[model samples]
Target: MPKLQNIIVLRTFAIIAVVLYHCYCPWLEAWNWYKCEYRSLYSFIFETVLVGRMPLFVCVSGYLFSHLYLDRGKYHEFGNFLQNKIKRLLVPCMLFTGLMCLILQLNYVENIVGYGFHLWFLKMLFFCFMTTWLCAKYIHQIKLDIIAICISIIMMFISMPKFLGIGQYFKYYYRRDSRDNGDDAR
Candidate 1:
C-alpha cells in the first residue's frame, strides 16, 4: 500500500505537540523573566494543541485501522491480528510501564492501582482496540464506531469521572483527577 504522506506528517507533528505539552517550556519562563508558571502562554498551549492532539491521533488510528483491515478483508485472520497487536502494542507497553512505575517509585509518587504508569496511553489503546474487536466479532449487527462511543459513554457514567475531578480549576478540559489515591481520609 502507498503511504499517505499527509497522515504520516500529521502524526509526527501531533506526537511532537503532545510531548512538548508534557515537558516544561524554558522559553516561556525566560520571557517571563524566570517565573516558570503553568499559565499564561503555557496554558494557551495546553488548551490548544495539547488538548487536540490525542483525540486527533486516536481518530487517525481508527481510520487507518479500518482502511487496512476492513478494506482488505483481513478480519478473518483473527489470530494473526491478535498476535500483531500483542507484539506491537502490548509488549512495549508492559516493558515501559514497569520502568515508569520504577521511576515514580524513585520519586515517591504515591497512588493505588499502580496509577497506570506513564504508558497508560498504550494500555488504553490496546484495550480499546481489543474490546472493539471482540464486540465486533461476537455481536455482528452494530456499527463499530457506535459501539465504541456508546461503551465509552457508559464507562464514563459508571466511573463518575465528574466526581473524580483531577484539576482544581474546574474550567479545564481534563476534569478527571489524577492524584486521587483512594484515601478519603486524606
Candidate 2:
C-alpha cells in the first residue's frame, strides 16, 4: 500500500499532544520536567489532550499493523513477528527503563515495574500485537474481533492483576479518574 498521509498527520498531532500534556502540565509534577506557569490554561489543554492522544496513537498503530500484516505480509510468520516486536518495542522499553533507573539513582529491582511510568504504552502495544496476531492466525473469524472487544470491555471494569504488564490498562483508567478528582497519586 502507498504511504498514508492522513495517518502521518494524525501521528504528528498525537505526538504534539503528548509533548504538550507532559511538558506543560503543572499538576502532573512527577512526569513534567518543567511546569508551565499558566496552570488553568495548561490544565485545560492537558485534560483535552488526555482524552484522545493515546487512543489516536493506538489507532494509528493498529492501522499500520494491519497494513503490514495484510498488505506487506511481513507479520505472517509468528516467530518473525515476535522477534520484530521484541526488537522494536520490548528492547527499547527495557533499555530506557534501565537508563531511567540509573539516572534517577533508583533501585533497579524495586523500580522494575516503573518501566510503565513512561514506557507503558510500548509494553501495552506489545501485548496487543500478540493478542491480535493470535486471533488473526488461529481464530481466523471476523466475529472474533467483536468477541474480543466485548471481553475487553468487561475486562476494563474488573481489576487487572498488577503483573505481567496487564496492570497498565487498569492503571490508565485509574489515573484518569484520579486526575479528574484532583488526586495525583503517583
Candidate 3:
C-alpha cells in the first residue's frame, strides 16, 4: 500500500499540537477542574488548541483506520484486527502507563484508567477501535457513517463515568469522529 504523505504530515502537526497543549495544560481550566498557577494567555491558547488538537489526530486516525480495515465499507478479519489493536495500542498503553506510575511514585490503580501521563490517548484510541469493531459487527442495518454521526451526537450530551478506561470516551469523544476523510486517498 502506498503511504499517505498528507496524513503523515497532518498526524505530525497534530502530535506537536497535542504535546504543546499538554505542556501548557497545567495552566488551563477544565470542565471539572485543574490547578492553575493563575489564569493567563496560556488558558486562551490552551482552549484554542483544545477544540481541535485531538480531533485533528482522530481525523487522521479514522482515515487510516478506514484505509486499512474498511475495504468496500466492510471490516474484515475480526480476530486479527482485535489482536493488532491490542498489540499496537493497548499493550503499549499499559506498559508505559505502568512504567510512568512506578517511576513517578503515583498510584497505578488510580492512573491506569487513561490518566497516566499522556498515554491516555492510547487507551482512548483502543476504545475507539473496539467501538468500531462492535459497530461493524452488530449494527448491520444502519450505515456506519450514520451510526458514527449518531454516536458523536449522543456522546456530546452524556458524560460516561470513568471505568475501565471508558471515561476517556466522555473525556474526549474521538470515537464519535471515526468517519473523518483521512481515507481520501482510497
TM-score top scorer: 2
Please give, for residues 102-131, the per-residue lDDT of candidate 1 as tens digits. 764533223212334444455445655665
TM-score, per-candidate, Cα-based: 0.65, 0.81, 0.74
lDDT of 3 by residue, 1-186 (tens): 578899999999888887776666555543123466746787677655555777688778867886766655544777788888889988887888889778868788887753545676677777777776777677774686787677778777776765656766544543443323311111
The regions of model 3 sitting more than 4 angstroms off are 27-39, 71-75, 137-142, 170-186
Q: Write candidate 2's Cα lDDT for 1-186 as tens digits.
A: 588899899989988887766565455453444444556655665766465776677778878898788778889999999999999988887788778778877776554564444666777778778877887778857787677667767765675654546665444422223342331211
Instruction: At residue 176, give the lDDT of candidate 2.
Output: 24
Alpha-carbon deviation at 121 in model 2, angstroms? 1.1
Candidate 1 vs candidate 3: the TM-score winner is 3
Cα RMSD, each candidate:
7.7, 3.7, 7.0
Better of 1 and 2 by lDDT: 2
**Which pairs clash (backbone N, Cα, C closer than 3 Å) in model 2?**
none
Could you give me the TM-score of model 3 versus the true structure?
A: 0.74
Q: Candidate 1: TM-score?
A: 0.65
